[model samples]
Target chain A: MFDIHLDFDLLEKCNRCGACYDICPSCLNIDGYDPRAVIKDILNGNAGRWLTSVHIYQCLECHHCLEICYQNYGFENAMTAMRLRAARQGIHPPQVRRGWDMFVKTSRLGEPSLAARKKLGLPEPRESGKEEFLKLLEVYRMRRHGPSPCLRER
Target chain B: MKEFAVFWGCTIQARFPFLEKSVRVVLKGMNLPFRDMDGFTCCPEKSLVNNIDHGLWLLTAARNISLVDKEAVDLVSPCTGCVSNLATAKGEILSNPRKEGEINSLLKEVGREFKGTSRLYHLVPFFHDEVGIQKIKQSIKRDFSGMRFAVHYGCHMMRPSHSLKNDDPLEPKKFDNLIRALGGESVEYSTKLMCCGQGLDRVDQHDRALQMARVKLRELKNTGVDAMALCCPSCFLQFDNNQHLMEKEGERFNVPVLYLTDLMGLAMGYTPQALGLDGHRVDTEPFLKKWKEISSRPSAAAAFSEGMKKEGSFI
Candidate 1:
C-alpha cells in the first residue's frame, strides 16, 4: 500500500511560517481559503472539519507555494493530504470523482478525436496503453487491498 | 540535438487537436527530432490521480517515463502538466531507491523498467534552451517587432522547481525570452505569474474558475496586449474556452490566447489557417489584423530616410 504520510515536522514549520500565504493564488483570491488555517487545523488534529469544506479543493495545485516555501514543503502538500483524506472518505467534489473514474477506466481522461485528426490532416494517433494500464491498475489495487474485490468480481 | 518523444498529453489530443497541429507544424518546420511514441498513457495528472491514489499516480508516470527510457530518447511535451508530473514522479523515484524498486517490481510484470535517464522538458523551455533563441531567430521568416504579447508561463512549466528545474519558478524568463526573440514585446502584468486557476474548473467549481480567469483576462484586456501566449492546454482552455463562455454570457474579456507554437509558426511564415488558428474560440482576427498592418508599415528609419531623399539631404 502507498503510504500517505504528511511530514508533521515540515508541516509544523509551515504553520509557523506563512510565507506562501501572500503568494498562493487561492489564499490571496479565494476568501476563507487559507492554507495556514488548514495547516493549523491539521496540526491541532482537527482536519476532519475540512474534509467536507470546499476550501480543501480550492488549491489550484499551481505549486507557487512549493516555490516560495522556505521549507520546500509548500502548503500544497498539506492541501493534497487533506484532499487525499477527503477522497478516502468519499467526500471529494463530484467532478474529481468523475475525472478519477475516467482516468482509471481509460488510462486517459479522453481519447483523440479521430474526426478532428482527419480534418486537420494529422497523422493517425498512436495506440494507447489501456489494456496494460488496466492490468497495472488491478495489480495496484490488489497490492493495496489484498485481492481487490472489484478485480475478483470481474 | 537528441531525439525526443512528444508527449501531447490528454487535453491537447482530445480537446485541442489544433494545438497538436500547431506544435507539429512548428517542430517539423524547425526540423526538430521529435516523434509520437505509442503505448503512453495520461501523465496521469497529479491533481487528479495523485490526490486520489498517489501510488497509481507514481506507477502510471513511471511506466510512461520507462517507455521513453526504453526508446533511449529524451521526453519533450507541449503540455506543462505532463512534463511536471512525469518529472516529479521521476525525481521521486530516483530519490527513493526503495520506492523506485517497488515501482520497478510492479513495472517488471509489464516488461518495462523506469531507468529515469531521459530528460523531461516542456516545449517552451525545449525551444528556449535546446532549440536556442539564436537558431529560432534565424529560422523565422518574419518577426513581431511591433506587436506585444502577454506570456502566461503556466504554473506547471516551472514550479515545484525541485523536480522540473527547467526555469525559475517565481521570476521565469524563458517564455519572455522566446517571445522577445520572435521580435514581440512580452507585456508585463500583475497576474502574469498568477495561476490560471484552471484547476478550479476540474473540481466542480466552475464559477470560481471563471473568477480566476477573470482576474487575468481583465488584467490582460486592460493591458491592451495583442494576444496572450501560453504553452499549456489547460491554460488555453481556461483563457480561450472559458473566456469564450464568459463572452457568451455577455461578460466580454475578449483577450485572444495563442499557443507559443502558434506564435512561432506565424513567425515562420505559416498562415493562421495553416496553423489551424481558426479553431480558436475567441477571435484572433483583431490581433492578426494589427500584426499585418504593423508589419506592412515601414521602419521609422526608412521613413525618415525616404523623407530626406524626397527633400534633398542636408550637407
Candidate 2:
C-alpha cells in the first residue's frame, strides 16, 4: 500500500536544500518550474494548488534532484505524491491517462511490432506477465480498499 | 559469464525492434550467456503506472523480477527504465519485510512469489562491469577511432543513485568509458548528464518534450558532434523520433542518435543494415560517412585534428 509517501521530515530537508534547483534540468531549462514553491505549499498543507498543476508532472522523475539532494530525498518525492494524488482523482494528463489505460488492459504500452520484428530478424517475443499481474492485482484489490479510482471508469 | 535473461522491454519490442536487433547482434558477437525468458511485462513504466497506482506498479515489478528469481538467473535489460523500475521495486521489498510479506501473500494467490534474489543490470553497466572493456575492445573488428560522439546517459540508466548504483548519478563515466573503449571520443558537454526529457512526451507535453529534446540536440548540433549515442528506447525516441519530427517541422538540429550496441555492432564489422541502423528516424549516414572517412585514413589522429580545425574549434 505504498503510494508515494511524502515524509515531511524529508520534504522539510528538501525545502531547506536549494542544491537541486541549480542542477534539476526542469528548474534550469523550464521556466517557472519551481519545486521549492511546491514544497512550501505541501509543508503548509496547501498542496491543493499543485495537485492539479502540470508543474507537479513536470518534475520529469529524472532523479537528478534525488542525486543532488543532501538528504537524498529530493522534491521529486513531493512531486510524485502530488502527481499520484491528482491521478487517483483522474486529473492527470490525457496522454498519461491513455497510457495508463493501455497498461492496465494489456499489461504493456504496446505489443511487439510483428512486421518490424520480422523485418529486423528478431526472435519471437517471450510471454508477458499479464495473467499473473492481473491475478495479483485482483488479490491486492481484494485485500486493500475498493479498487482505486485509477481503475474506475471516469 | 553467468546466464541472464534479457528483458527486451515494451518500447524496444513494440517501437524500436531495430534496437533489439542491435543488442542481439552485439550480444551474439560477444558470445555472452544471455537468455530470453517469458513472464515479464512493461517494467510497468514508473511514471505512467506508478503515478496512477503505486501498489500495482510495485507488484508488477516484483512479479517480473520473480520470474527470473524462480529460475535463479540474473536479469539484464537494454531499457534503462525497465532495469531502474525493477531494481527500485527490489529495493523497496528487500528493505521492508512486512511489505514483502504482504506482496508475497498476494503473489502466492497468483502462483508467484516476490523474491528479490536475482541481480538486475542495465546492459550498459553489465558490459562495463561484467564483460570488461578489454574483451569489448578485442571484440571490435573496426573501432570508432578519431570519431567524436556525445553520449546521452538517459537518466534512469544511473539515477536514484541508491538503487541503480552502477555509476555516478550526476557525473557518470561508464557509457563514456564504453564509447572510449570502442576508440571514440566521448565528447563532454554541459548537458551531457541531463535527463533526455522523454518523460514529458508520455505525460502529453509534446511541445515541452520537443523543447527538452531541442535543448540537448541544439547543443550537440552547435557543438558539431558526429552523433548522439544513448541506451534507453525512450531517450532514443526523444532524440531520434522527436528529432525527426522537429526537423520535419523545418527545424535544423540534425544530430544523429546511436544506441550503445549499434556502435558496438558497427565495431564488430556488422553492416549498419545488419544492425538495423536503417530503421532509425534520423539518418545515420552522416555518422557512418564520418566514421568511414576518419577510420579509413592511415593517420586517424591527423584526421581527427583536421576535422576539429575544420569545425572551427568548439572542440
TM-score of each: 0.98, 0.94
User: Residue B180 of candidate 1: its Cα lDDT?
Assistant: 95
Per-residue lDDT tens digits for candidate 1, residues B1-315, read 999999999999999999999999999999998899999999989778899989999999999999999999999999999999999889888999999999999998888899999999999999999999999999889899989899999999997789998888899999999999999999989999999999999988999999999999998888899999999999999999999999999999778999999999999999998899999999999999999999999988999998998898853
DockQ of candidates 1 onward, in order? 0.83, 0.75
Question: Candidate 1 — number of clashing residue pairs?
Answer: 0
Q: What TM-score would you give candidate 1 relative to the actual structure?
A: 0.98
Model 2, span B1-315: residue lDDT tens? 889999999999999999999999999889999999878878989889999889888888988888999999999999999999999888988888888998888788978877888899999999999999999999988888878899999899987778888998888899999999999999989889888888988888888998998899888988989999999999999999999998898998878899999999999999999999999999899889988987777685677888888899945
The sequence of per-residue lDDT tens digits that candidate 2 reaches over residues A27-127 is: 98899998999999999989898887889889889888788777878888888888888987889889888999898888899999988888777888888
Clash-forming residue pairs, model 1? none
Q: Local distance difference test, per candidate?
A: 0.91, 0.88
lDDT value, candidate 2, whole model:
0.88
| CAPRI quality band, candidate 1 | high
In model 2, which regions exceed 4 Å deviation? A146-154, B300-315
Model 1 misplaced stretches (Cα beyond 4 Å): none
